[model samples]
Target: MQPTTRLKKPAGSRNEILTVGAGDRVYESTKLGAVFDMLINHGVPADVVLRDVNIPHQEVHSPQTRISLTQLMTICQNALRLSTDRHLAYRIGASVHVSTYGMFGYAILCCPDFRKAMDFAMRYHALAAPLATIEFSEDKADARWTIEPNLHAVAESALYRFVTEMQIGIHISLMRDIMGPTFTPSEIGLAYPQASDFGLPQDQIGCPVRFEQPANQIVFRSQWLDRSADLGNKTTYPTIVALCDDLLGDLKLRIGIAGKIRAVLLRDIANPPSFEAIAKLLDVNDRSLRRQLRQQGFSFRGLRDELRTQIALKYLRHTTLANEDIALALGFSDAANFRRAFHRWTNKAPSDIRGE
Candidate 1:
């Protein structure tokens, strides 16, 4: 794992939905500002989109607030569905100016060179609160970032592609912010097939695009790494990182028992510990823990099952993992038992998901 890499999880409902309220799943992070603005510019109703995602109307309107993956994902779904633009992700993502990213963007702008900017991005990306994991590396010929969006159980999902494309657009836009507007990636590689004429509105971020790649990648020349940034400042860069570090501490602070348990569980989600184990780790008795969850409108079983169902569906939709393998990974007894429980939770056969 790279030093800068991190991933997050989801929650919702009656089956695939988390039993907890949307409030519990949220963290006090920045708003989905630009995405919503772009959606509205396209004539999509912001209220309708928020309603579809089951978020408060005020959440998106506020400059800073709590947001969860369910809220973000559903917002994208509604925005894409309601809008007429086919290349919505590319348009909005590319149009994003680094200044809109707040202090984090400003820090990158202050870096002495592209190399420092890349390193700064690796370490400080959490300040931006990205949903996808951005991995950076370099070979003799090329410097590359292989981006993997979370919730990619089905690589072909519109949600996945939209999120991924948006990331690509941000890279193009932000690199231009640091490296200059004339900078172009050596190439762009996508894990999924091309959707429509992907490069339409060709005046933006024009680069060679390859489809059906093993990973989503943005490749550029290693020579560019040494290129000096236009606004490199020794003073502002460290100050920005220090402020962002403080912000990160605040983000890492766990507020509720549910959130605390979620952090512990996700650490080793593939082989989850028992209720007793979680209880011991939290320095609480089982009865106390149970009471605390009930107060939050959730149960341990519901929380664990919600995470499992979410990941299982991701695997079913995104990967070709055998039923037995996914079951074992989730600590299920067997494929047969896994299938039965999945139906109970989702009211549909597991195969039914893959079929769709």
Candidate 2:
């Protein structure tokens, strides 16, 4: 028999995504068009896949349209429900290429090397319109990309798998686009257990896959970062990057004051900027920041607590970091404060939820 340990859920339950930027609706709609079209190709009626998604196929054609992550999650849910292909997320992702990303793709094409491309993508990933939140990191031997759907009130392992696989598929497709068709990640990690129902992702991923891992990550060699891109252009790269930066700025504006604040806070969540300092950095007066947050039915403290709660949970559930270290990561002065804060945010003791 398998051994099991006590695993207490987070505030909304462990299954909920509960990301930092909780209420942003900045995702591009065109991405979902692919999912919609895929369903259609699978003999699923257009209306059937879009039942409660409320997005019209025509609207996605517009370059300016944006949708919420919740909508994307709903579309994936619908797609999974009606389609028999359990690896539908990977299939949808595999179909994506540089051309699918619009200006974001162009910026990547202009990158001089794989390292530059990875940096460029990480810096402007919001433009790529991922179904989940992805963070990039590197160590001595490997470059890694971690995925988190981070959707508010979202649960269901199936939905998580769908979002995670689709994102990985997109990464693989884009890597192949720039690094030649031969490129593939060294390993893939899935947060969920390997169950028979979801189908085998390794078949489509073409890489070693590990399940019940700390995170959903795509890992590749650090040396591959030096590989030259087939389409890299030293001259045009800067110009394209400039345009991409402008596009990113515009997108951030659309993401709103709270969303922007969340992004800034995430940069240094362990020692987040003071609300006043953040206001000044964002070039908005404190009054305006407070008013905007109030209008959105949020307060800075509330947002901070929510972000801290999620980060705290991730640390406890994913890492074996001592409570004091996790406390430091959340900007708590000491472990006792972190303990109290954790109890306040989650209504459960930290030790109760820490993964075995």
Candidate 3:
């Protein structure tokens, strides 16, 4: 059997593999119209979704307002039927590039080394349009390019859309940015088999193309990872890398704060602390902490509740605690309160969560 590729699931138990900037995926002005249209057509209650985002039905049809990631996911959950199909998402993403940053983007991408350019793409892709993730993978002999979807309802389709368009645009731009649009990949692969008009552009460069692969990806010789032309755009690539490293660190804390907070809670389980106390320990103010969690696409209450629920379930399942004992252990006031809270957390009773 092929070695199983296991990825860490999100707190929501999502099986997605790509780490994406949730904020960046939303908030792109250019993508507002197409996404809105798709959502409305897909059976979401337009008014309800609009209310969730404070956008009116008319404004969604208008060209002025942008959509947020949260709004889009809510719509996808309620509307899009094939949101899980990764390929469809990629196809949608390919069309979004037109409204995104135009030629300057091409110039920046083509000028940088492969690694630096990839980092820039990941970091700023949200700024241009929040579609999918572009990441690099390397082994001893070859480098692979892959696309990952963000946490939208249409996770798979989104991944497909990102990989397809990104491969097409970046490949063409790579050569154009260097040698006036004449450069071409000696060999190319497309995960989706259907032909696109884009293949015609390869005629200009006389390169071989392959389609229908295991994943929407490209493989290239490692030697090509570096370029010699040295068109040197004056932006320091190393500085960009350093900046990406710093931002990634911040993102880790943001996304994984629940786990970090869980650790602290574990340490203080005997004497559960207040939110203010936890915020002070983490070196953030209460409001700032709440805002950061919101921006990072989560809530402090959600995290705390999840942690407490986990502890309650653990105690119920593994230990011989009565419901009242489990309640006390998890800092709840009493057995009744614990049962109500656990029901809220799992949509099942505490006993059900414990399989009792």
Tens digits of per-residue lDDT for model 3, 250-355 = 3333333443565677785646677789889998888887776665456767766766766777787898789998878777788899888888898888767567
TM-score of each: 0.64, 0.65, 0.40
Candidate 2 lDDT, 252-281, residue by residue in tens: 444556677888989999888999999999
lDDT agreement of model 1 with the native:
0.71
Ranking by lDDT: 2, 1, 3
List runs of model 2 lying over 4 Å from the truth.
1-25, 257-356
- What's the CA error at residue 4 for candidate 3, in Å? 21
User: Which candidate number would show the highest TM-score if scored against the true structure?
Assistant: 2
Displacement of the residue 30 alpha carbon in candidate 1, Å: 5.7
RMSD of 2: 17.9
What lDDT does each candidate get? Answer: 0.71, 0.76, 0.52
- CA error at residue 86 for candidate 1, angstroms: 1.7
- Model 3 TM-score is 0.40
Tell me the tens digit of each residue's lDDT in model 1 across 237-283.
87877776655434443336777887888888878888899999999
